[model samples]
Every structure is written in C-alpha cells, then in structure tokens.
Target: MESKSKKQKMSALEQLKKFTVVVADTGDFEAMKLYKPTDATTNPSLMLSAAKLERYHYLIKEAVEHANKVATTTDEKITEAVDLLSVLFGREILNIVPGRVSTEIDARLSFDVDKSVKKALKIINLYEERGINKDRILIKLAATWEGIQAAKILEQKHNVHCNLTLMFSMVQAVACAEAGVTLISPFVGRILDWHVANTKASYDSTNDPGVISVSNIYNYYKKFNYNTVVMGASFRNIGEVKALAGCDLLTISPSLLEELENDTETITQKLNESEAKQTNIDKINIDESTFRWMLNEDAMATEKLSEGIRKFAADMVKLEVVVEDFIQILGK
Candidate 1:
C-alpha cells in the first residue's frame, strides 16, 4: 500500500492524464505502451518513420506483397501498398491502445471531397475486414472545406466517424464542429514554431500562441455545446502540454511523454465546459466563403495548413518510393 504523500508525487504525465485523455501521437507501439495513451494518431510522416523501423519492417513487406499481387503498375502498387500499410498500422495500434486509432487519408486527396470520402471509406472497409469495427477507428482527413464536407457525409451517411487534422484557425474548428465531425486535431507546436520564426519573440506556456489557440477553440466548443472533440496535437514542449492540460484530448510524442513522466509538477485543469458556458461567447458558424476569408486573414493558420498538407503528401510519396524499391528487389 502507498501512503497519500508518496502518491502525491505523481509525475506530470499521470497528473495530466487525470484531466485530459492522454493520446500517444506516435506510430510506435512501444511508445504507446510506455505512456499507456487512451488513443493514438498517425499521419503519413509518422507512418513513414514507423514503417521503416526494423521492428516493424514486416508491415511494409506485407503491404508490398499484397500490392504486388493486386497492382499492375509501379504507381498503382505504391498507392495500394501505402493504403494497406496505413490500415496495418492502425490495426496494430488499435490492438495496443484501448481506444480509437486515427488512420489518415492521403493528403493529396485533401482538396477533393468525393475522392477523400472514397479513400476514407476504403480505409475503414480495410479495417472492418480485419475484424476491427468502425467504432474503434477514426478516418482522419485534412481540415479543408472539401475535407470537412466529406467528413460530414461520412458522419451522417456512413456512420463512420472522422478526425479532421491540420486544423489551425478558430474558423477551421468552427467549421468542423458545424459539419458534425467527430474530432479536430489542432496543430499546437507548428503554430508556435511559425510565430517564433517570424516574430523572433519568445513565448511562455501561458501566452504561447499554440496554447492560446487550443484554449480558445476548447472554450468556444464548450460554449456553443459543440460535440466535436478538440484534440491538441503536435506539441513542442511539455509546458505547452501542461498549459492545455484540461483539453478534451492531446496527442503527445514519446519524447515529450518521457519529459512529463520525469517532471512531478502539479497539473491544473485550465479549461472546463461549465466555466465556458458561463462566459460570454457568441454562437458562430463559418460559411464556405467566410471560412476561406477568415483562414486567409490568419497568416499563421494559412501558411501552416498548406505546409502541413505538402509535408504529408511528400511523406506519402516517399513511402511510395520505398514500396516501389522493395517491389523491384522482389522482382530480381
């Protein structure tokens, strides 16, 4: 039995877990086990890194073999292989975590609602065929106008939940909630990096642009009674994590998870739905044009969204190359 004072020395990670659903933002199974995250998120970039790990090397090989049987051309094989790899990673991560695993659609489909919807459904079907129900998976899409529209369709028609990623602006959050998307993962570290690079100014946890962005969106969602889950993601440091301690969810990297485990700082709940409801906030929704204009007005959000999409797409391309190279080797 442990004494009260001894248990009081709980690490910041444990403390934060008390307030928010701690999510492992990595594709590494060991990391998810290390932190015991409730949920997990993976994008092309994370998946690309994970697919290359020696421990998980078999996944890409498996994908390559399956693709080789079904695909006729290098381009077709690469696409099929990557898609299968995404679901493979999702399945493995789901087995490790008790909650949902987010599997993203290719970022190249970010602008086409129909293609995004089709690709998302294909991923979900792949998971379902593996005996994993749609309930335990989130079809992650970019938070573009088209992506949000596709999410709405998935949520309403197919009963498949969606996780809107690359979210940066309040307008994006607002639009996502209005679309009845299951969740939105706002990029916290990327926002902070943008501010730091351009402004050449320092930021503490309290006034960190990333922290403030998530907080504002959290409060707004609570105020308006939106059911969309606000997940703060892509964290740079533990301070940013500590500041959004009470967010609905936060996807944190393994490196920062280690930092939280070592620090025994007191974690406080900063944002509460009850408090937000009592605060003054206007009911708001963003139309397509308004959404575009508002997003354009916010330079940080605009730049980050485009850059994020490009990065994800580039990773997808790189993953394709790996698959193609592996396929060529097998042909020898």
Candidate 2:
C-alpha cells in the first residue's frame, strides 16, 4: 500500500502542482470546469474566441444591453460594452475556478497609464456589482513603462491587484517587481517565437529562450525578496511548459493542460526559494532610461514586446467590431 501511494505521487502533474499554482489561460469556462485550475486568465483574444462559440453568445448580448443601460453616446456605449464583456467572461471563469480571474484592459491602452487605471477601476466596479469580491480579480496590464506605472498606483492606492503581462525582458520584470504589482507574466512561448523566427533553429527545454526567460525572472524575484508572483505564459509545447515546473504559476492552454494530466513522467523541482537565495546576482536599479536602454539592447525582448502588443491590440479591435455588429443589429 505504501509503495503504491508513493508511485501515484510521482506523476508529473501532481508533483508540479505540489509547488506551483496552475492557471488556465483560456476564456472557456466549461473547459475550466473540467480542468479545475486554481485561477483563469483572459485577454481580448481569448474573450473574442469564447464569445464566438454559440454556447457563450448570450454573454455578448448581455454585455451590450448592460452597457446601453449606462452610456448615452454610440462610442461610449461600445467602450463600456466591451469592458462589461471582459468582466462577464471573467465572472463566468471565476465561477468554475476556485481562485481569482485576470481580465485584461485594452491593449491599445497599454501606453496610457491614466486611461489604463481608469479602465481597470471601472472593470473592478463592474465585477463588484456582479457580487464578485475584489480580491478574486486581477486587472492584467501590459508591462510597458506606462502600464507598470499605472499598476503601481492601482496596487498602492486603489487596492487593485495587477498582473503585468507581455513581459519579455529581465528589465521589465525588475521594474514590475519594484512597482509592487501582484504578478508578472513572462511570456515563454512568445520568446520562443521570436528566436525561432530570427534564427530558424530548434531548441530543447534546457536552452529554450522561453524557458530561460521565465526561469531568470523566477530566480531573480526569489533572490531579491520580491513579493510579485511570476506566472509563466504563452507556452508553445509541453516541453516549454514542463521546463518551468517550479514556476510560481503557469497559465496553460486547455490543450496543454490535458497533456500534463495524461503524462505520468516524474516532474522535478528546478526552482525553490532556498535555491534562489544561494545563487549570487547583482541587484541593480532600473529607472526609465536604464529600462529603455536595456530593452533596446536585447533584440528578442524589443521585437517580441512590440509584436505582442500589436497582436493583442488587433484582437481587441476585432472584438470591438463584433460587439459593434451585435449592437447595430439591436438597432439601439
């Protein structure tokens, strides 16, 4: 009996869960119900994909009607409606998962700190009105300079937790930690995407840029005693996901989640607080200039950050168009 129990405990998914929080990266509430992740994250792209499914079409209608009740102008109505839609999807995912839901603001607002803060607060209010606790939400922002700045204020003053996303550089991670944000999502797959495109080379998990990116951030945070959680995002394959087994959190796609569940290979811990503390690294201050300079020096980070923002912004526009068409059909 004891030997059987020990063998069962050796499953990769179970062992990985022992140290890190698992978050589902999609907006699909039904799938989340099955996988039972500790948290869920949604961006415009994910929400748009979910809204297209006939099962979730009602959420789109509900958001439009909900927005029309508050705003007067056509533009205002569309804007408010999109915000409501983001919250509505988040609310549904929250119901399935036992933990917080991270809903992103518009990617176009990534550079406008003030606008991002206002948008984040409004989303919080929308969720609150729906009877969800504030603590059960994280307003995901881009890891741009402005976005990081806005998150600091939102965390310090408004008591709103922030997840700095689209992070591809160590400098960005350092800045986010300094800002005292709730979490930082270092995109592992996107980092891999950039390297593959430029070098046209394949990499195993050991040397994968994506895996190395998250690992560096994770080690740095632990070494410096930062409270910000590091969540590895945008994994391209099971190897990329498995490489980051001991990350603070890893938001994975539903497809990848299934891979983890089926695999019984032993998952070993590669990172821990004690291990991080023993490694010596220089802690440096990153003001705006240093942050910008460091990012410029790294080609992968520079290209990937811009590319990520553009892709998300494009998806945001597409989602708005969908909402616009839906509203036009309503003839309001």
Candidate 3:
C-alpha cells in the first residue's frame, strides 16, 4: 500500500526527471524557479520577450551602461549591450539552476565563421568577467556549416563548450557530432510545423515527425558512440514533450512543465542507449560538400533551418532596437 501510494503521488514530471534532464526553455526567471530545470536555454526571441518585462529592465540598464562605458561608436555600443544583456540573463539563470546555461551568439553572425568565433569568445569573456567559468556556459550557435566550424574551434582549440541550435536534419546532427561540439538542440516543434503545414494532417505523439527526428538522431548518436548531448528544443505540445521523455535532455516551456507536473499518470521511457544500440542503422560521414548537398536534398531541413536563422536574426535586430532605446534614455 505504501509503495503504491508513493507511486501514485509522483507526478509525470518527477517520473520523467528520473530518466532525463529537464531543461526550462524560457527566459522567465519565475518559471525557472518554479520548474527548477537542471539547465536553461535562451535565444534572441526569448530574450526579447523577457526584456520587455519590468523586472528585467534593470538588467537592460546595466548592460547599456556597460556598453556605453566600453564602446565608442553606436554600432559597437549596441553589439556590446546585447551581448552583455545575454550574459546578464545567463548569470541570473545560473544562480537559479545548478547546471549550465546556454547563451546564444548574435544570430546575424551565424554564417561568418571568423565573426562567429570572435563573438562567442567575447560572450564567454563577458561571462568570465562576471566570475562565471567557461564550464558553466554553453555558447549557442546556429548549425550552419560555418557555425559548426566556429564551434569546432571553440571546443578543440579554446576549450569552450557549445550548443548548436536550429538543427532539423540528420546531416546537421552528424556534422555537429563530427565537429566535436558539446551539444545539439534539435527544434522538435518546428520540424513538426513544417510537416503539418505541408501535409495538412494531424499527427499523434507517436507519429510526430519532430519526435521521430529527435529519436532517430538519438539512436544514431548512441549507435556511433558520439558524445554530443542531444537536448530537444521548441516543443509545440505536451504530447510532443511526452513522446521524447527519455531524450538526453528536453528543454520545455513552463506551460508544458506545469502540465507534466499536474498530471499524475506515470510515463514510460521512450529512448534508451541499450535499445538505441540494437537498432540497425548505417553511418555516413558528413563533409562540407556532403553536408550541404544532403541538407539541400531534404527540403524540410533546408527550409526550416533558413527560416529559423532568419527569424532569430530578425529578433536580434529587434533586441538591438530595445537596447538602443535604453541607451538613449540612459545617456539623457
């Protein structure tokens, strides 16, 4: 009776946490505190949303002041301010979560390897100045060819960790693992969005294209003995989150986390290394040309990756404008 009562008392969230690391996928500190995710991830869009809130205004002010003190030109100030703001949020998140935080590089720098590497290093430097170590930070970059290369340099040459975002296809995963990147966040919901829009069909959790993509990537990584962490991101529904329950990690929004917490039903492990290793699969080495060609061949991956970059880049510009407004007010 006691064991049965204890089992019944466990929420699905607690049960799921037993198998996988639950990462809060929002910039909301309150949500992060409530969910107590092991790690946290932030992007331009999430940061932009958080910046508009009154509670985060002080962070913006500090970032602007830091930028003004260091940078002479308006362009330099905006860049510095945005980077500082990202680090500031990351710092606060680190205080709440015991694990690391994934702070993004400027999305516009996604295609330029040199610029991306420089920006990543700058972000890491900013965090270090705040007394945060390199090990507790994961610099997020888009999974473009150049972004992967930049991550390679940061990981191998500089010993900085990286989380490659905007991932959709197997090619991106293979390339990231091959580059010795630290982690990869495959946007599960976005892939499902692409398939649903094209096919005009509804999918259950089991048959979700996004879930399948992550599962396949997980199996492949386990099969090949790749150490790159697979953290599923951008979930659209609780069903999708439930489907990828046993992923290495799942970065879920606060809403889904709440739902999982409220539901008392126990969930099953959907992915495990033992079962993954037994799956029959072939491995393909992804070179620069092969990666591009394969990515181009998959219309879904091609369109989604481009769209994700463009959207994040657009939000980055909007974030800069927010910083500019702060700069004007603070300068006055």
Candidate 4:
C-alpha cells in the first residue's frame, strides 16, 4: 500500500509537460536529479555558483588538469578550461535529464557574429568527442542582431541547433524565426523588472508586460507555423510561470519547481493560437538598421540587454578565477 505522503506528492515533471517543457535552469546536478526536468540550461552565473559548492569540486579539478595538459597558451588554457567545465556540467546534467542541455557562448562575444558561431561550434565538438550526440545539446547565444545572423549561418550551413538567449522584444523573436534557429529564450522576470522600475507600481501577471511579451511571441510563432520553440526563462515568481502556462517551454528555477510540486491546485491554459487569431497584432519585419534604431529608442530594453551581458560576463571571469585557484590546489 502507498503511504499518504507518496499518494499526495505530485510530480512536477508531469504537471510541467502538460503546459510547457520543463527545463532545469541550474548548474547543480544533484538538485536537477531530484526534479527530473526534461531539459536543462546553464549560464556563467549558475556555473560560478555551482563551482563554489563542495559537491562540484571534482569538476573544477578535472577541468584544470585537462587545461594544463593540452593548452599551448594562457588564452588557450582558458578556452580549454571553459570547454572542459561546460562539458562536465553537460555530462552531469544529461545523467539526470532526458532532453537537451543548453551551454552558452561567452557573453563578451555576443556582438561578434563570426566569433560567436565559431565558439558555439567548438563547444558542440567538445561534447561530440566525449560520445555525447549533438541532438542533446543546444548552443546558447545572446540574441544580438549579429548573434541571430550567426545562428542563421550555423543552422543552415553547419546544421547546428541554437537557443537564442536574452531576448525581450517582438523584433528579436521575428528575426530568430526567420533565421531558422531551433529555439529562443524570452526572459519573463527580466521584462517584468523593467516594467516595475519604469512604471513604479506592482504589476499583475494577466496584464503584466513580461507575461504579455511571451504570450505574444508564443502566439506569433504558432500562428505563422514557425518551428522555433519559445522557452520562457528568468522567472521571478510562480505567478509569472502560471501566466505563461502554455508556452512551448519554461526554464524554471528549482525553488519555483518545488512550489509547483507542493501545490495540487488546478492549472489552466492561458495562451494559444486559436485565441491569438482573435486578437489584432500586426506582424512587423525588421532589418538591421531598424532593429538597432528600435532597440536604441527603448531605454528599458537597451539597458536591460547590456546589463544582462555584463552580469554574465563578470560571472564568467569569476568562474575562471575559481578554476585557477582549484588548479593550484590540485597542482596542475
């Protein structure tokens, strides 16, 4: 006979798949296993945090040893170290999750289309050499105009899949779809953060700018039959997650995943194409000049985009320092 606790405990994975693809947006492999998310995502910030934990010590040590053995220069060592760390995390994540894992390129290269594409391909190759198939990896890059263009070439020419990150507007989403990228991660919490600071008032999910942005993107993709998957990311609260109940995917944090798991309340569908057709939303095609001008005009978008990049870049540097310190301790 099943215990009351076992009977009452609902699976977050089951509820998550009904509305959106469940993605574990963390670098902690043990936590990821407990939730059993379908997919997983990692940024420099999450990796830095994970490396600080005692449980992930071996990953840093191994990365340093690998770096010392094969790298010809300091720059090469850093690159090799980052690649090794990314693969270590990816391998650990694959053990827990059944779907793909997103490993990001350096944020500092977001504006350099060619460099971003090359780096992405490098990371994918590293994973491949380890016997991990390409299908289970999504190269995560920032959604700069150049980044999208790079993704276009990578998809059409190289046959590599991508997940465009730090996306905020319709223009970016439209460009990604046209580029034939595999997925786009529209940040829900970050958008809400912009709205709250600008409006100076608390916002509700139904009418929240962030919630509406993702809903619009999801509907647009579905309406036009774009195969690009829209995975809503950077969630601040459960309300934002609930608001985007029907997104193609939602990469949520473990805390919110826990909340959803504990509650047994009914969840409802929010956004769909059938409803989208009823609303009047004009589709706009964007060129490089227009895209830049539009981004320049929107202070919130411009500021948030730059801020996100800097934060991620800083985290990457910090992670490198941690790796170096770990190497010294390991004598490699």
Candidate 5:
C-alpha cells in the first residue's frame, strides 16, 4: 500500500517547485540523496567536518595519495590535497544532484584578486579533465570586491560560472549582478549570528535583520531583472528557509532539510517582483574604495565577513593536516 508519508513528500516537492529552487547545502551523500535537492554547495569547513567521519575517510586518503605524487614542496602538497579533496567531494555531489555543485576556492585567496581567479580556473580545469563539463560546476569565491572582479573575468573570458560567497550588503549584490556572475550566496544565518552577538538582542524571523537583508537583496535583483541567481545560504533554522520561500534558491543544511522534510506544514511565498517594485529603494553604484568603506561602516557585516573568512581558512588548514596524516598512514 502507498504510505501517507510518501504522499506528503510528493506534495512537498510539488509545493517547493512552485516557489524556490531547493539546494542541499551539505557534503553528506546520504542526506542529499534523501532530500533530492537541485544543487549542492560545499565549503572547506563542511568538507573538513565530513572528512572526520568514518564514511568519508576514503576521500582524505585518496586526496593524500594524489597529493604525494606531484607535490614538490609542503605547501604544494597541501594545496594539491585541498584541491583533490574538493574535487572528490564535488564529484560525489554531482553524482547525486542533477544541477551544479559549488566547490569553493581557498578562503585565503579571498582578498587576492589574481590568485583567486587562478585558483578558480584551476578547479574548473580539474573538473573538466575528469570528464565533468564546466557547466556542471560553479567555482565559489568570497564576494570581496577583488573576488567579484575575478568572477567578472572568469565569466567573460573562460565561460565559467561563479557562485559568489560571503555576500553581506546590497552593494555586494548589485556589484555581482553588474559583473555578470552566475550566482550569489547571501548568508542568512551568519548575518543573524552577527546581529545577535553585536546587539545582545533576540530576533524572530519576521523582524530578523538577516531575514531583512536577504529580502532586500531578492527584491533588488527582481526589480532590476539581473541574470545572477540569488541562492540564500547559511540558514540557521527552518524558519529562515520558510520565510524566504520565494527566493530564487535557498541552500539549506542537512539538519534544516530534515526538519522541513519531517514537518507537513504549508510554506507561503514571502517575496516577489511586483511587491519589490512597489518599494522605494534608492539604487547606487560603488567603486572599490567606497564599497570597502561602506562595508567597514556596518559593524556587523565588517565583523562577520572577516570572521567567516578566517573560520573557512582555518578549516581548510585543518583539512590539509587530515589529508597529510592520511597520506602518511597510506605510506604515500
């Protein structure tokens, strides 16, 4: 007999298709298979956590072995290991997801325009050599001004798509859209995290600053008809996900995806262009200096942006160590 759970699950997928593109923001293949999200996103931090798991230990070992063969220096070995680990994860995710999988560049390259672009192209080239088409991958980069410029060049010259990460402000969003990047991941949970830490104030979804930030960006994008896709990322809870139901896309963590799957409740659309066009928002362009200055002025954005980069970079280093240890164990 058909189960009630099956019926409800079908209904949820039907409903989800109406409003947003659901993305699985995880490195766990088991979870992603169950959720059946359109795309998958991963960062060094998530990859590091996944590496510690027994199920994913093979990735570490494989990366280490691959690194040992070609690396002439310690730094080269580390970078090679990271790239291998990222590609392994990306390949696994691509097997499950029908759409793109975002593989992030090293966060340490966030502020270095040339290095970030070079690394991004390298990741794409690695994937292509493995028979993965460039269309199936989006190179993720920190949405610093430098990163945006790099994305611009990548888009124009190499025909590579980009997923701009760590975006915090309207300025950043506008800049990305203007640059002709493919996608933008505006962090919802991280913004809330900053607000809570800075103000010592509690916030509900309706009034949450993070919620407002995403909504504003969505509205702006829809208003101007930018081709860049807005994928709301780093959600804290199911509430944030439900609140932004009509966003172009939302990259949700495994726990939150589980929560949404378990609940049989309804999700309503909260954002659309008609409503966005009704608002009176003044649009402005910012140069590099002004963009940085504006970012610095927003205490929450300034702090969280720096903190996010450091956290991702530290995790990348830890992941490098794990890969190195695995290589040593394998006698590679």
Candidate 6:
C-alpha cells in the first residue's frame, strides 16, 4: 500500500486545473465526459463535424421538426433549424459538463451588431424555453468591432453574457475589456500559424508569438484590474497549454487534453496577479476609431481575423447544406 501510494502522481492536466479553469473546446460529449471541463465551447466548424455523426442525427431530426413547426418559408425553416440545433447541442452539453456552454452566433452576422444581438436573444430564449437559465449560456461572437459593440449592449442592456472569439491582438482584447465583455478567447495556435507561415520560422512554447500575445493580454488585464475573464484558446500542443498554466482559463482540444492526462510532468504557475502587478505595462483606452486603426495596423491580426471569420462562415454554409439535405429526406 505504501509503494502503491508512492507511485501515485497527478497528471499535467490535473496540475493545470489547480491554476486554470480547463474548458473543453470540442463538440464531442464523450470527450467532455472524459476530461470533465468546467465549460464547453462550440463553433460552426465543430457543430458541422458533430452533426455528421450518426449518434447525433437524432438532434438534427429534432431540430428539423421544431423548425417545421415554427417557421413558414424554406429559408426560415433552415435558419430556425440551425438555431434550434445549436441550443439543443448546448442543452445536451450543459447536462454533461455541469457548467455554461458557449453557443456561437452565426458567423455571417459577425459584422452586423443588430443581427448578432437579435440572434443572441433568440438563442437565450431557446435555452430558457428548455428550463436552462440565461446565466448558463455564453453567446459567442466573432470579436469584430461590431461583435464587441453587440457584446457591450448585451452585457449592459440585456444582461446577457458573451464570449468574444477569433481574437488575435491586444487591440481586440483591450476593446473587449473596455466593453465589459464577460470573456475573451484569444487564439494561440492560429497566431503561431500566422507567424510561422509569414516568417518561415519555428517557435517553441516559451517564445511562441501566440503564447506571448495571451501572456501580454493576461498581464495587461490583471495590471489594469479588468474583470473580464481571459480564456486562452486554440492551442496547437500541450507545450503551449503548459506554458499558459496559470491563465484564467484554457479551452483545450481533446487531443491535447489526452496528452496532458497521460503525462505526469510537474508544472509551475506562469501567470499571477502579483507578477502582473509588478510588470511595467501601460494601459491604453481604445475607442471605435482607434480600435479599427490599431487592428488595421497589425497585418497578422487583420489577416487571421478575416480568415477565421471566412472559415467559420464557410462551415456554417456547409451546415446549411446538411440541414437542407436532412429536410429533404424528411419530406420524402
């Protein structure tokens, strides 16, 4: 019994959970049950992938039936089906994770603040209809200028929480903080991808541009006393995950979560308020024009943001096709 106890050790993932709230970044419920993340985040791409699975086809059928009952035109039915499907997935995930589920607004609405806000309200209403409280949901927006503004209105006016995603720079992060956003998902792997593709250089976790971006944002938020949660997202590897051991939250993919669970490496806190307070970082207030100008100035950020939006939008289109096909089958 002494030898067995001596052999026991906490995995790197367990160590990470001590300092950071680990969020599962996949649509797979099985993965969520295994890793047991405090939160789960989903996007059009992930939903598109999950909707293709046979086990989840029931969800698609249910969504289609709900749409047929509520909507008039074919386009309207498709839209309703998509929205209902997202909430259905969120509802299912909420049952498993025991925390909030982030159901994203349509990426096509990323540039339209009014539409985004309306859709968010619609999503929240869907959740509420199923006895899920609004507090249990985080409406995900694209972190565009319009998205940030929508979040500001939702948070201040409607009492809705938001998670700003596709963020790649301090300009976006600072703007989000100023807007009193509930959370901001600064993507790490995508930033590293842009730098590597542009400069043709390799990077490790310590000096990774993505890691540096999140660390800087985390420090800035802490130093300035922002209440917004910094959730480091889109990690490419466990090394990047380990580097951000002390982030407020880290939404990791299942593959990386598996890696962390299998390895028993000791990790230390890399971010803390005490260290952040000691840093010589200056705070900058970002208004609309300055936000636009700053984002325009950062080539990598601009490119990546546009690319991320387009990819998500394209996947949303693909999801529409899937819904349309399923609707046809039902008609047959």
Residue pairs of candidate 3 with colliding backbone atoms = none
Off by over 4 Å in 2: 1-11
**Residue range 103-136, candidate 2, lDDT tens digits:** 9989999899999999999999999999998899
Local accuracy of candidate 3 as per-residue lDDT tens digits, 1-332: 98788666989899889989999999999999998999999999999999999999999999999999999998999988998999999999999999999999988888999999999999899999999999999999999999999999999999999999999999999999999999999999999999999999999898999999999999999999999989999999888888888899999999999999888876899999999999999999889999999999999999999999999999999999999999999889
**lDDT of every model, 2 decimals:** 0.92, 0.89, 0.94, 0.86, 0.86, 0.95
**Residue pairs with clashing backbones, model 6:** none
Error of 6 at 40 (Å): 0.5
**All candidates: TM-score:** 0.96, 0.95, 0.97, 0.94, 0.94, 0.98
Show where candidate 3 strays beyond 4 Å.
Answer: 1-8
Ranking by TM-score: 6, 3, 1, 2, 4, 5
At residue 192, give the lDDT of candidate 2.
88
Off by over 4 Å in 6: 1-7
Q: How close is candidate 2 to the true structure, as a TM-score?
A: 0.95
Of candidate 6, the 10-residue stretch with the lowest lDDT total is 2-11
For residue 111, model 6's alpha carbon misses the true position, in angstroms, by 1.0
For candidate 5, the 10 contiguous residues with the lowest summed lDDT are 8-17
Q: In candidate 1, which residue pairs get closer than 3 Å at backbone N, Cα or C atoms, i.e. clash?
A: none
Off by over 4 Å in 4: 1-13
Instruction: State the lDDT of candidate 6 residue by residue for 1-332, as single tens digits.
Output: 96565359888989999999999999999999999999999999999999999999999999999999998888998999999999999999999997889999999999999999999999999999999999999999999999999999999999999999999999999999999999999999999999999999999998999999999999999999999989999999999999998999999999999999988879999999899988999888789999999999999999999999999999999999999888889968
Per-candidate Cα RMSD to the true structure, in Å, reads 2.0, 2.4, 1.9, 2.3, 2.2, 1.4
What range of 10 consecutive residues in model 4 has the weakest lDDT sum?
7-16
Candidate 4 structure quality by residue, lDDT tens digits, 26-131: 9988778887889999999999999999999888778878998998666677778877898889988998899999999899999999899889888888889889
